[model samples]
Target: MTSSNGLSSLGPEGASAAARALSLPAESYGNDERLEAMWAMKAYNHAEVYFNLISSVDPKFLKLTKMDDEIYTKFRETFRDLDIKVLDPELLKSAEAKERWRPFCNCYEGLVEDFNFGTLLRLDCREDYTQDNSIFATRIQFFAVEIARNREGLNDAVFSAKSSKS
Candidate 1:
């Protein structure tokens, strides 16, 4: 079957053949664990970009506007609807889990329709790469929480914490 992007869906045999052509190990391509790892890595990279963008701004100039707060509230409700504990960093690995979260943001606009994936945040959690870490979150989720933090003077605490450790 052809997808909306006009890319034909590859069945198992075709996928395996494609993987072979690309010189990928059979265990890596189309493997759930491997796919999850790739998703996590991609999310992490995206989050890092967002963080750098936020950090580049002067904290005093980063106050959230009314619209930012509204976005944040909308995100909170989205999480609530999904039965995901708000602010608990957990990677939404399944298509179903991601589908429930992505509509709130234009993260995938101009991208393929089947491109569904997102991250979560656990700021209180340690910096390790474990699921508890907050290093990965959906683009909009990151913006919502971080914008709220900036407006509420929470980033100051984070900055202080980082400076103290240095």
Candidate 2:
């Protein structure tokens, strides 16, 4: 986590490099405080895990770094495109994962009108802070979470089926 300089965890260049690696505009992502938080939580290791996934796919520098350089590269590109302000790998992955699962959620809502305890377990919950009114936002947030959950379920089902077939 600590950069080569040893003054800060990510020195000025290292932070900027990390930001650039995440593809944020200058001064956009991973401020010192957020980096500090990541260090505190040992999120750096998770970032490394993600980096490994990317490395397996790309392998641009297979012998140079232990980390997955490719996934880090994708993260950079995505963060830049999304204009994300925060610098947490899990949050970024969650957002990315949400996109993949959104469609399954949309389909589930129209087909299911009732919920039981098991039904509730299949919902994806999200907080909506951007609504014009609190009531609408809360309602929409709940709906969105449920849809997200359904999408996730669909994804799991598909993945399981594929694995079984293989």
Candidate 3:
């Protein structure tokens, strides 16, 4: 029953419900500061390795996953209209985009290890993974788009630039 007091007035059931609610995450539901830091570190390392790879070798030959061909094909089929060469911020971060991406992400659930783990994606395939140019994505999403870029000859410019410098 409603009363002047809080949960105590409502009795044990209300108190227990309140206790459960209080136990939920303070910030975002799944967020843990320490775990977030770890994910950031992992994303940074992967970005570095990917940068080094595209810088030295032709991105066409650089495969991030064992099923590179399949990933590329499915990505193209799923997102036929998406311009993978230029990773649009709206496409990456919008609520609409998340809904659109959910089924595509789910397809790789068993095929790719940690497919949904957070990763740093370069907004522009032609540029380095600078802070302003990067956004967080899933591992499979990153692989799919990057593989598409490489196959489409979008990332060849990075190799060309590096070669010119050498």
Candidate 4:
């Protein structure tokens, strides 16, 4: 599945279909290691906070769950695998990252605007951000929805193509 650009065929057909269904093949779908790093830090922070809250005097106030932490961790790893380099550590430590990655901010919006699921999911996760923690849950939500849609769409596309061919 080598692309015309000579990149390995973006992995496998199933993954390709998932990418297409997510509308991520055109952009925001490739190697993005830096973004991955930032996301990892943010997710770790989010999980840590959630765990502490769920176990402590403020558990009622935080109301976080192990499931929430798991999901965040999964998304963090997935984004890490992207190998994106949008936000360098030094750059992130700068004032610009602070302003740009603020909670409820759409800095990563550019990364997932191609698809409805991704966009919607981004919005959903923004609700969890704080001034101190800036990992965008929306990105994870968007990825999950996009991936699900991709799988479903791939099955449909293949089934239809096969039927038409027969």
Compared with the true structure, what per-residue lDDT tens digits does model 1 show for residues 49-75? Answer: 444434455444564443565665775
Error of 3 at 133 (Å): 0.3
lDDT, model 2, position 1? 16
Weakest lDDT window of 10 consecutive positions for candidate 2: 115-124
Give the Cα error of residue 5 in candidate 1, in Å.
32
Better of 2 and 4 by TM-score: 4
lDDT (Cα) of model 3: 0.81
Model 3 spans > 4 angstroms off: 1-30
lDDT of 4 at 75: 40
Which ranges in model 1 have alpha carbons more than 4 Å from their true place?
1-32, 49-116, 125-131, 135-137, 163-166
Clashing pairs in 2: 22-76, 23-76, 51-68, 52-68, 54-71, 124-145, 124-149, 125-145
Q: In terms of TM-score, which candidate is strongest?
A: 3
lDDT scores for all predictions?
0.49, 0.32, 0.81, 0.35
How many clashes show up per model?
Answer: 1, 8, 0, 9
- Give all TM-scores, in the order shown: 0.43, 0.17, 0.79, 0.23
- Local accuracy of candidate 2 as per-residue lDDT tens digits, 30-55: 47675444433233343233233322
**How much does candidate 1 score in TM-score?**
0.43
| lDDT-best of 2 and 4 | 4
Per-residue lDDT of 45-133 in model 3, one digit per residue for the tens? Answer: 77877888888898888878899988888888889999877779899679999998899899889999988878999998888888898
Best by lDDT: 3
